[model samples]
Target: MTARTLPGMTTISYPPKPSPGDRIAVISAGAGLPGLLPRPFELGLERLRKEYDLVPVEYPATRKMGSTPQERAADIHAAFADPDIKAVIASIGGDDQITVLPFLDRELIRANPKPFFGMSDNTNLLAFLRNTGIVGYHGATVMCELGRPGAMHPQTADSLRAALFTSGAYELKPAERWNDINRDWADPATFEAEPETRPAAGWTWVNADRVVEGRSWGGCLEILGWLLMADREIPRDLAEFDGGVLLLETSEEMPSANEVFWTLRNMGERALLQRFSALLMGRAKTWSFERPNGPEEAARYAADQREAVLRAMRMYAPTTPIVFDVDFGHTDPQLVIPYGGLVRVDGPDRRITVTY
Candidate 1:
């Protein structure tokens, strides 16, 4: 579908580059796990300073684990209002960023529009920024991407570097090797090197006969469900998403396949499922703090999640193209996606390219 076909889904744009000396604010809009575990947080900060050549700044609530929603909102406003800060990154995703949404000052954020990066629970802020006509990022939380054990995932590093410093179309490739297994960060040894990853199962595509391109919308499925239930930033008119691409991923919470189906079924009822021409499903994250699945169990979990997605698409968007096992969301080596940015899904070529 051409861009003209989609109304209310404008292709948002931003400055092409952030200079080396630029200052980027790091805030914990949701969880301040940086307070509890400094391993990844410190490492992430170092990368921002040493590798990216950008100074990393933190807000008052950034490292406070139990900070209130109002405090988090205050930090967000402070980060955006500061003209010296070129971009904002979340320290990590938390469970209640939605609660902080009501306290956000839309006018302030709009006045000082800058790049904001995050994912998972950060979906709340991403949706908020989208409504404000600002294109926010959907991946690269400091604790997850920057503080990744050992070294940054190469694909993730390259994707983020391009997103932060360049303005153009960047192609996304499935990870050659991916890890769904969890490593305990509490153990000091986990920080010495990267976690183990198995061979990639590659991307699974459906209805691969045509090309579809549009502005991307959607985030962690569970977070999207919350937004739906709360009737938050999602456009009231389902047609607003027509011709757009719907990108979704599940978090570490490991919601069951039944849960995934039920969430999509509700979206179908809202008449929101068919608005998109294609769906990009990030690989399911099967391992978490509560349950660490073995390789066999992890494979089953990913398969079940895919089956659930197929079931939903069959009922709601039967002809839409689908590419599964994308490297985004709660998995290791997450790729940054631009919320409301241009994304092209080339089914025939078996490729996906995102313009950030």
Candidate 2:
């Protein structure tokens, strides 16, 4: 194994409490699907009011389907800069949130920091917030968590509640039941009940024996690739990632195993892979509108993705423990992970936990 001194990841202090009756901003930093389909969006808002007991405030462009990057950035600034808004939540993930990153007013956000919640395309903003020394949340998008059909997934609800209300170490458990199949949001029946789920195959572990704890880093692997290409928020020194738990997930676009391996290989060439002590691989998202896979095909796809991850780890850091099929990405029952927060990877105990 390659040996190097570990540099400490930057720490961002969490904000004060936002109790019931406080206002939270709800913005669509990526896709404004709320305009196209209001069922899930409305349900998500209702849950914020009933379950969380916080009022959700929306922006002018929040529900606009084709909102421009400047418009979205304005909403972000307004939400963060406002003293009344205690938190900000994205409606859903989209394809071009990277474009909105450049337009963000860093000084404005730094002056007034609040907890931000999102994932997928929101990876761009999460990374941005981390760079700004603000602890942002990696999961729990409004539509996916609050608006979940039938009821909130128990795992998701618990994780999100802890991340939102409490501040401490929270253990992450592999979802006992998980779902990847989609129900059409356009169909009213889809909102009448929860989507079908299959028994979880459980997490796959590699190099299990020791415990590794570190500050967290990384986001959707695809989004990180874009950030690297654009020379965005990533630190130039590989040492910046040392002693850090790198969390990565693939988006619904479903890049092939070869592509995933190539991405990690490039990072390895840059001397980035060996710096991390452990990896949390988000459960592979197998089904999408473009390429809908059956159960057997979906299983194969997930297995292939795991093999690709192992191949890259073998070439980079052979001793690093990896826990796979974590439900924190494009999968249903997604748990919230704290970006730039402390994560403990207990290989001996087969437990993964994060401090939010």
Candidate 3:
């Protein structure tokens, strides 16, 4: 493992990528949504084999709804220790992954570092991996982006392909159109058709006068807040984050504008906001079952959240460069971002690239 340090932070290692023929472990480290809704999960497995050419191995508790934290941790241990399993991925994200952290054998994982791919509630494990000096991926789960209603978005598939097998700089482009609403996974008809999407307005830039390149950190804001509250994997020395790029996104819970502001405010209060040189904010997910917002309302919600972010940045890290509406969070056609790996945000060129 190779280590790179950013100011006060300890060094983080980027684990080697797996070959095409390597085996990948798909575990339900969070919620076992796979058991309740099997169509998307099974489709994702098929894609991993035929589309990506990687054999996916599942654990005992991968689809168990009421799995204990220790059970989940055991699966993680098994996946990491086995030499044949070259990588690990989460089946889906859920609410209680924080409980599994304490049960993890950190030394065991660190000794045999392998790439881990996940997001949302899986943020818990990603953060844990980061602190262990191993980089993890922050997007592309089995039952979500990979198993979309119609098929994997071309952009998402391309991004996942590069992140999975290649080791080089890959430029990221905004999808000409994007989807935020998804069909009911339980309904078989959902798999027969594609989700609806609207045209994209492209990315919005702030402080676009220069370029900033650094290792990536941060994940789902709500989950990060939970980690901070529980005093989990966050570094005690604030300067560790200096000169790093921050990756911030929200989940499907659709937090209000005020909630977004306060979360940033809390990070600012801890002096965490000023550490990063740039921020990559994922496009806000505006629609959900409980909050079935119309187009106008969804637009307003996104606008409000953007304003909230700007407000927080101005109050704290006034000069930090920020790129908004990166297609990597809860939205459809998501891009996979490397956690604790290198990212180049070229403001003058209006481009973003990640090293796989």
Candidate 4:
């Protein structure tokens, strides 16, 4: 999100960018899957060094599964405190990152702000950083985007590169093709080729008559629900999000349409849903290991999720502009969204641009 100039409010600033030769911390803010599955993590590290020309540094808890909150917090502290560490990227996302929130020293992180990159359950840390007045990236993790089977999706790589090394308005485009089906990471053959993909359906827009520009705020819907439940990170005064853009996406766990509706309905009940100038809903990830539906089933799932979101917004923020199936979730060619960054939604032109 862009820096808010409102009186008596803290300005959320973009952290300094990292140079190609800079040292970037590869920490596990969530699960230390790197420890369990080394190939993809190693591949990702090689890319950081060879392709991106950045040095990857790992901390103690970065590879220790079941790491305690205090341990993970310590790694976070060390990464930011070290002047040599120019940026921090999560290894992957996991379920229990919220437990680590209490152990974080917000002031320490704020004092040494670094661009933190991650999504999924790492939404906990992203929201934490925003409250601390540092803009965290809402996409790109070591194992997911960085360690994709074959090569990075050119779009994902370009978006991430811009986010890492530049500061300017970057236009977000719809992917020509996208994939949600995943192969077992444990299988050695999975890395042999890129996953199959389907032709992308362009984003669907609602209220396409206006242009809305504002600082952005929001993350994975499930994690957001958890934050609301724990009552953490969110401002005591909900007005902080007034006129901001809201970015939301679901994860591979694939919550039902009812679950999505109820969570957003609860936000509406809190008087929080109507605050945004626009909503960017990431494409629903319909296929999962547990529920690998074919084309027909997947289509139905996506349609249901979209309807649920529309139903909630119709009740709470009927006039708000919403664009659904924006390809930036647990799908291939995931675009990087700046968490707490400036976004310009030109609905009349059907274009989206975010400040990197």
Candidate 4 at 26: error in angstroms? 0.7
Number of clashing pairs, model 2? Answer: 0
**Across residues 1-356, which tens digit of lDDT does each residue of candidate 1 receive?**
00011126433566335678899999999998999988889999999999899999999999998999999999999999988999999998989999888888877887888999999999999888877778888899888889888899998999999889888799998888888666776788988878888888789999999999988889999999998888888765566688889989998899999999999999998888888989999989989879888878988988999999999989988999999989987887788888988899999999999887
Cα lDDT tens digits for candidate 3, 239-294: 77888999999988999999999999999999999899999999999999989899
What's the CA RMSD of model 4 in angstroms?
Answer: 2.9
Off by over 4 Å in 1: 1-11
The global C-alpha lDDT for each of the candidates, from Candidate 1 onward, is: 0.87, 0.87, 0.91, 0.91
- The parts of candidate 3 lying over 4 Å away from their true place are 1-8
Inter-residue clash pairs, candidate 1: none
Q: Runs in model 2 with CA error above 4 Å?
A: 1-11
What range of 10 consecutive residues in model 2 has the weakest lDDT sum? 1-10
Tell me the lDDT of candidate 2.
Answer: 0.87
TM-score of 4: 0.97
Q: Tens digits of per-residue lDDT for model 2 on 1-356?
A: 11122234545666655777889999999999999988889999999999999999999888999999989999998999899999999999998888888788777887898889999989888888877778888998888778888899988988888888888889999888899878888888988888888899788888889999987788899998888777777765566678899999998899999999999998888788899999999999999989999889998999899899899999999999999998998898898998888899999889998988
lDDT: the better of candidates 2 and 3: 3
lDDT comparison, 2 vs 4, better candidate = 4
lDDT-wise, the better of 1 and 4 is 4
Alpha-carbon lDDT of model 1 = 0.87
